[model samples]
Target: MKTSLYNIFSWIRFTFLFVAVLMIWALRTLNWIWMRPNRLEKCLRKQGLNGNSYRLTIGVTKESAMIIKEAASKPITFSHDISARVLPSVHNAIKRYGKNCFMWIGTAPRIHITDPTLAKDVFSKYDDFQKYYKTNNPLVKLFIGGVISYEGKKWAKHRSIMNPAFHLDRLKHMLPAFHSSCSDMIRKWEKMVPEMESFELDVWPQFEALTADVISRTAFGSSYGQGTNIFELLKEQSHLTLQAMDSAIYIPGSRFLPTKWNKRMKEIHEQVQASIRSMVNARVEEMMDGGETNEDLLGVLLRYNLKETQQNGVGMTVDDVIAESKLFYFAGQETTSGLLTWTMIVLSKHHEWQDRAREEIFQVFGDRKPDYEGLSRLKIVTMIINEVLRLYPPVVELTRIVREETKLGELTIPAGVSIMVPTILIHNDHEIWGEDACEFNPERFSEGVSKATKGQVTFFPFGWGPRICIAQNFALLEVKMALALILPRFCFDLSPSYAHAPYVVITLQPQFGAHLTIHKIKH
Candidate 1:
């Protein structure tokens, strides 16, 4: 009996050992096949592109994180030129390496292209350099979770169906929502102030609230209170997502671990998705039941998508609608809020420009609500807004993925490479914008975008190419509308408490709140 038991134990041990060896071999083989960087890095190196040679697994990710964290820790002097502070890692890499270089994020090589001509190609050619997952950050993909994830025919269809919602005529309909939301915010500011005297207030939260309010009212015909809650949830999700990127290192299946952050992130996303889904389904049902057709984004999308389906036998699904609505919340809210915030701060500093804008606002509308034509005619105001966008763009950077081995310019970009299309870096490039690139000058955009770039296709505060922001008109209108109300009603200057540290938490924004001293205009 003892001899028989011993034989069985030996066989069991041998079987377990065999299975472990097989599993290890399979994992290593998969890693080598999918995550190895020898061939592409070698090609990039041969082409004279500089940067750290590719390392296994983490691959300069840890070093890059250290560079970023260190940069953030040591704040710079009060200045608008935040290219270094905003993108220190990239800046450092550019210094250490040449202009055209490559870094690694896991096994993926990030080919940093700073040349404007090549950068232009990156944006114009959608297929060769496409946007898959941003920097291979799964958390970003999880939060973005929108049509941006799609490619080829699907992407075209998605863009097609959603285009009508942001059309010129459609945006005209949203003006009332914008006006009403901004009015409520200013009214509260009026109440907060002691009759015409100046008072300090952090306009950051106010702008945040205002944008959320406008998105709520315009997107779903919901009140500020309701939209505030949903926007807040999304805001939290984005914060957590960016934090996860900072805290967690790149690894296979790292996000799925049952860590506290992972769990909380998953839960928050679930809640956001659920809330958006409910809104989408209700709107779709209302459309089907022939109820009052809401003209807000949700309603228009339903109607527009219905037509698309009827015409081409294809349209955004219920989930597709949901993703878009969330995108509307994310991009629409974040972009407008940041734009307005930085505009207010810059206008505060450039008090001369602030006065000029008010003069233009009153000259155009004279205390009346701004119409689209009138707003369009406010050149000074538009210049100031454009300058603010150039100085402090909402989105600091855009990126694309090299899906297949592709040739852009002189270099052959290999598959499994990522591209960085930095908006701020290019916007502030002295070479492109001349000596006063870093200065706050609104005259650059006076003649229009084409004339501003001298027909180079630069000044893409709203991005460039076919994938240019659909909400550009909408956002510009909102800023025009918001500033028109605020400027004529009150004059503001940067508060003593306000810090000028611009940072990036997904979008370029003032790290500290934008506190300002507001003085009412005596009639």
Candidate 2:
């Protein structure tokens, strides 16, 4: 009996020892992955590029997190030269390692490509340098999780199916929706300033709501009033997401824990997906019933997707359609809002240019509804929008990763390394844009981007190459329509309470809120 007990104890001991050995091996493997410099990173260094050394798993994440927190704690003085404030980590890296340097975003060694030629190459070779699996936050996939997230044949198929929806004719058909939404906002403003003189209000949230309203109508065939619940939920989700991503607040594995925020984020995502599914299901039923339906974005997308499935036996699944709809809700609204806000803020600062824009608007539309032709003719407005996009773009950066060893220019980028196309930095570079690059000068874009860059591929606010934003034309048209109507109705100036602190969450925004004093324009 004693011998039997001893044998059993020995077996238990053996099992524990084996487990310990396995754990140590797994840890060593993980450490290797976390700290080992890839061939691409080595190659980059050999080619004279510089960066921070790789550390286990975290890399420069802790350092960047601390720096970003510190920067966000205090607002910089009123100015647009906010590269330092907006991306403290990137700015510090540039200051330390020069403009051409690498930085670590988690495990990925992100080479900062400031050269326009290199930038162009990165965008052009979309297949070679694939987008990182957007599950960066996991739930972020719900919002920007459509065609922008696809690659190879999947991307080709999705883009082909959705192209007709945003074609000039389709977008032009949606102009009345844009006008109606813009007019609704104008009416609200008219009521606020009932005396018909002037009023001081924070136009930031106003524009946010206005853009959200426009997107709701165009994207879902529902007005802002009708889609208020979805928009509210989205707003909540976004705030929660930003809070979760906050460098100062983030904790690994916390998202998996039953924390309030994690639970809430999951709940919101579920609700959003369910809402989208219901909308799509109802639309599909109506289409199946042969009932005429409003030709909004969802309607167009469904129609095309169904036609494809019937003809070719391949098309977007219901979930896929839901993803595209959610993408439209977020991207369609977020960017145009930023554009309008910054344009107004800048125009308010440069009253003369505002007058010029107003004069141009009058010259083209002249107390009439803005048509596509008139919007196209507003060269000055276009220039201002481009300059704003340069100075304060919606997305501050773009990133691509080398999944396998690939030669770009003189260097071979090894797999597992990501590269950053610092759009804001490239846009603000004096080397690319001359001495006045940082200055807000719409005149630089007078002859357009090609002429402005002297035929070099420099200005890429909507991005460059085939992977450029699909919704850019749609966003710009909405901006022009809203601005054309608003410019004639009111002339605004920055309120004394206005503090220009441009910061980035997901997109560039006026940190202090865009407070503008509005003066009703007299006929």
Candidate 3:
């Protein structure tokens, strides 16, 4: 009878413990989905920031996704005012809630910062407002989770190791690789076009291929074939990443599920990693044997990486090097491709700018290969590229998180709120940029970025402050080389089949394609 009583008591205790665990979980979830968001909402509202009250269901994430999809379905007329199509949801939010407002991305409130002073502050204070990589989809973490995703010490370490490769002197060594790739692409175009007739070709895919080839040559040198293969995998991986980020609703352990998209993404990730590792191992072996490092990015990186490991005794592992290489392929390829594609489209629209740029190219190089010094001297080409970047900046917005309570201008932002630095919006704001903000006038940047932004932190195509893109000079130099070669050889105008739909898939791209009538120039 005593034993039976003890068993009954044990069972009752177990039941009580289970119920307590269930209750705790329920409360935490309730806080996450409802109470916390509401509290953040109240905090922002109290600070005079306006926004729609946070909804417990999905917040505004689902609604914003739907709005973006609807906006991207149709093509906009040929005009430089692309913010409406590119960032429809954010654009509408700014219109409805004013510039000093917040929008919900899941439970988190993203505070829109339009003021240049506040933008500058947020950028300068990198530690306080660090990158927010918290995401629902794991694929995003797999692809872009490198130095760009890191903070504090790790970011500094990686940045230091990789900085030498992008130095102007090192980049000059890679100029030959750039020239070779551009020549190959232009040669292909020459073959396609008849003696003097125009050919309706898509420059978007053409530029994509050209940039990929350039990255292959400039990144891996002798391993160009392997580099090419890796980027092809990365390109597909980029698409799958966009699809994986379909909604904000995240189920715990959902990434482990054997969904088709998830499986393919994992496969591609492994393939890319293995490919990069193979190259790194081979290079390391060669380096240990006292082989001279080539001039490509890999050589410079490995050489610097060795120096770092020897001096600091703590350096990037093979895996770390692989991540940086992937970044080089992804960022280097995508940024230059987008910049060149847009420059062509914009120049085509405004033929006068094209004439001016071509004239400058001639005066600087005169049918000769464009050297770095001459490329730098091409002021008109520089202005056109800057204008293109301002109108269609590679990254539309920069996200930073407030892990602790932060102060921005007059507002005291609570912890867990996001800061949205919408570069596209600021770039196109008439109040800051005068009435013709949306128009594609390269003369706005005639003097330079400083004069264009009037010393404000408004024109950040590659970004601003310490965390600015490391490869900015590398990319601009390549673009100049391509233009220097092509501008004097051929002239292009938009094909009637072209649809002017600028949208973001990781970066801004033409929704349809950049179809143009390529006419060989008789010089």
Q: Which candidate is the best by lDDT?
A: 3
**Model 3 clashing residue pairs (backbone):** none
Model 1 stretches astray by more than 4 angstroms: 1-35, 134-140, 247-251, 254-256
Error of 2 at 504 (Å): 1.3
Q: Lowest summed lDDT over 10 consecutive residues: which window, candidate 2?
A: 243-252
Candidate lDDT values, in order: 0.83, 0.83, 0.89
| Candidate 1 structure quality by residue, lDDT tens digits, 224-310 | 787666788888888887776664255668777898877877787788888889888888788788898899988888898999999
In candidate 2, how many Å is residue 229 off? 1.7
TM accuracy, model 3: 0.98
Candidate 3 global CA lDDT score:
0.89
lDDT of 2 by residue, 1-523 (tens): 9999999999999999999999998987675565355544677789888998776556467778778778877767766677888888888898899987997766567888888788888999999988864235655554457898899999999998898889999999989999999999899999888666889988889988998898888888887886777777887777666654543223445668886767888888888889888988999999999988668989898889888999999999998998888888888878899899999999999998999999999998876889988999999999999999989989888888898888777767878778888888888898888888888999998998789988766788887899888999999999999999999989999899887788776778887898899998778
Give the per-residue Cα lDDT of candidate 1 at 88.
80
Whose TM-score is greatest here?
Answer: 3
The lDDT of model 1 is 0.83
- TM-scores for candidates 1 onward, in order: 0.93, 0.93, 0.98
Clashes of 1: 0
lDDT of 2 at 430: 86
